[model samples]
Target: MPRWFYQLASPRWSYEIMGKLLPWFAIVTAALLVSGIVWALAFAPSDYQQGNSFRIIYIHVPSAILAQSCYMLMAIAGAIGLIWKMKVADMVAKSSAPIGATMALLALVTGAIWGKPTWGSWWVWDARLTSMLILLFLYLGVIALNSAIESEATAAQATAVLALVGLVNIPIIKYSVEWWNTLHQPATFTLTERPAMPAEMWVPLLVMVIGFYCFFAVSLMLRTRNEILHRERRARWVRELIEKQ
Candidate 1:
């Protein structure tokens, strides 16, 4: 393993690195979200079809994207913890659940809001939507499993296995629109293809997506730092750091 990878396993080192990175992530998140929202709501042209209702995409799309990304990170982190016995990786996986759940919920709610106008109904059993709902449930399940287990290590392992099992849902969610007849529209952005929307609209959406990732980083770091301190309370470095503060 690389030196930095080994260093990351140290709770104190992880905590310190997060502390240094937090402020920067926080600043970028704030700036991007604010600018993106303003540009999206105030400046972007209304959709010819949906009019103002399209503005909700600024939130819904980003939240939905972040929710999926968070799950992948959580699952990968859990796998690392399971394979290497890295406490920091476990902390990251644990910290990720609530944030991912919240984002998924936000996506669902905003999707509903976006749906009412676009689909004539606030809710639908569209494949993409249903799979996204299942993703949210998966996050909740991980959280419940983690809380139910009394032993930290046992809890981490249990949740890791569950997360790994749940990984199957992600691709289903991503490809659902294309795989089935669904009310939900195709993805606005894809790596290999240009967005169908005009530059003015997609640019702000891109900014929001980047901002959402930054916000997730800030949230995860804050939660993981807290988990590190709590899990390492008995360590000499943790105790000394606490004393210094």
Candidate 2:
């Protein structure tokens, strides 16, 4: 195993690393989110087609992107826990559930809001929409399963299996617009294609996307740190740290 892997396996080291990283992620999330919102809403030019209503893209796109990314991260964490039996990985998998769920919900609501003006309907059983809903349910199911199991290790194991199974839905969600005759538009940004809009518009969107990721990291670390403390409360290092407080 790599030196870094050993370092990560140490709960004390993981806790200390997160403690150092949390503030940086928090600061970047706040700065980028605030600047991205202001620039996207006020300064960025509106779509020639949708006009002011298209402003919702600033929020909808980033959240939608983050929703999928969060699930991917959560599942990866679960896989790490399952394979290596790493306690920190389990904590990460558990911590990420609520954040992923919230991102999915925000994506759904914002998509609905954006839809009302563009698609002439607030809700639709379109492929992308339905698949995103499924993603939310998957996150919820993981949380529920974790809560239902009494043994922490057993709960983590079960949640890990569920998360791994749910990975199939992710690809479906990604390609739904292309694979199905959906009302939702195709991706505006792709690795193989240039952006649909000019730099003025897409730049802030890029910032927003990066900010959302930073925000996710901040939230995951906060929750994972709490989980570590809770699980390790009886340990000498943790107890000593608590006594110092």
Taken over the whole model, the C-alpha lDDT of each candidate is 0.96, 0.93
Estimate the lDDT of model 1. 0.96
Clashes (N, CA, C under 3 Å) per candidate = 0, 0
The numbered model that scores best in lDDT is 1
> Which TM-score value belongs to model 1?
0.99
Q: What TM-score goes with each of the models?
A: 0.99, 0.98
lDDT by residue (tens digit), candidate 2, 33-73: 99999999889998999998988888999899998998888
List runs of model 2 lying over 4 Å from the truth. none
- Candidate 2 clashing pairs? none
